[model samples]
Target: MNKNISAGWRDFHASAKVYYLWLALGWVEIRQRYSRSKIGPFWLTISMGILIAALGVVYGTLFKADLKSYLPLLAVGFVFWAFISTTISEGCNAFIAGSAYIRQMPLSRGIFVFQTIWRNIVILGHNFIIVIAVLAIFKINFLPGLAWFVLGFLLLVVNLFWMSALLAVVCARFRDLPQIITSALQVVFYITPILFKRDMLSKYPLLIDLNPFAHMIEIVRGPLLGEPVPAVSWLACTAMAVVGILICLAFHGRYRSRIPYWV
Candidate 1:
């Protein structure tokens, strides 16, 4: 067990040392994905802008929300949620998709997971243009709390890294897991406060308060929406990251060697 743990820790350390390799690979993926397109990834930004507009108009009316405030809220929440969801979904196939490299070279498997995450982050950056435009158009000035967004985004990324690492290993073993995760995320989307404000569910406060994703969204979204950082959310997300990382290390360590066989 200790040996497995040590191996797992070393895998992560080695992968971190070669950060340049994964960073470059991630960028290569983005370029390759839109190689022939003129606008490239900006196509994502355009699509996201349209979706945010449609959702903002439809749901805003459904909830009787003001367009100025509602549009900005929807834009930021959706963009971040897309990052979170796609990372996890793609993370499932991190090892499976990289089977060629895994078989050919003795590379750290964690690199694939990081690549999956970094790719989605790049896409998130594209989608975030919509968020910026919405914020500018709505004149939502949360510049004073912008520092909190940096901290929150870091915490969010850390949590996501552990999650992706763990999922990559498990899903390599169980091919069906990715489909299950995809279906689960659809449900999570509705339950999470992306499309609606948490306060809207005032009667059942635990639904939002107890949900880890809700806390994750709150730490980042709250800051941009001009709301004070929720102390509870910061604590919740920090605790989850610490615990999840430890769990991922142990699991990945024990199963790290077996991944090649599984993939």
Candidate 2:
């Protein structure tokens, strides 16, 4: 058991040392995805902008929300949710998608997980343009609490890395897990406070309180909207990251060697 833990830590450390390789690979993926398109990755920005606008109008009316406030909130929530959801969905294929490389070289499996996270982070950057636009148009003064966003985003990424790592190993073996995860995230999307505010569910406070994603989104979104960062959110995300990483490390360590065959 100790040897397995050590091996997992070694694999994680070695992958971190080869940051250049995965970083370049992630960039290459973004480029290839938009290759030959005139606007290139700006297409991501455009699409997200369109989605935010459309959803903002529709849901804003349905909920009788003011466009001014609702649009900005929706924009921020959607952008971050995109990063979280896509990273998790892609994580399911972190090892399976890189089967060729895994088979051809004795590379650390964690490298592929890093690549998956980095790629989505790049996409997140592209989508964040819409968030910036929303903030500017609404004149939401975010500078005062920008520091909290930095901390929150870091915690969000750390939690995502562990999620991706754990899913990568498990999905490589199950193959069916990716579809299941996708379906589950669809349900979670509705439950999460993306399109609406938590106060809307005043009677069902537990819904938001129990949701880790709600806390994850709140930590970042709250600051950008100039709302005070919730102490509970910070505590939840911090505890989740620490506990999730430990659990992921143990699971990945036990199953690391089996990934090659599974893929």
State, as a TM-score between 0 and 1, how close model 1 is to the true structure: 0.97
Off by over 4 Å in 2: none
Model 1 global lDDT (CA atoms, 0 to 1): 0.89
lDDT of 2 by residue, 142-228 (tens): 999899899999999999999999999989989899999999999999999999988998899899989999999999999999988
TM-score of each model, paired residue for residue:
0.97, 0.97
Q: Give stretches of model 1 more than 4 Å off.
A: 1-3
Q: Per-residue lDDT for 1-263 in model 1, tens only?
A: 67776887899999988999999999998999999999999998888888888999999999999888788878888999999998889988999998999988999988998888888988988888887778887788879879999899999999999999999999999999999999999999998998998889989989898888899888899888888767989999999999898888889999988888998
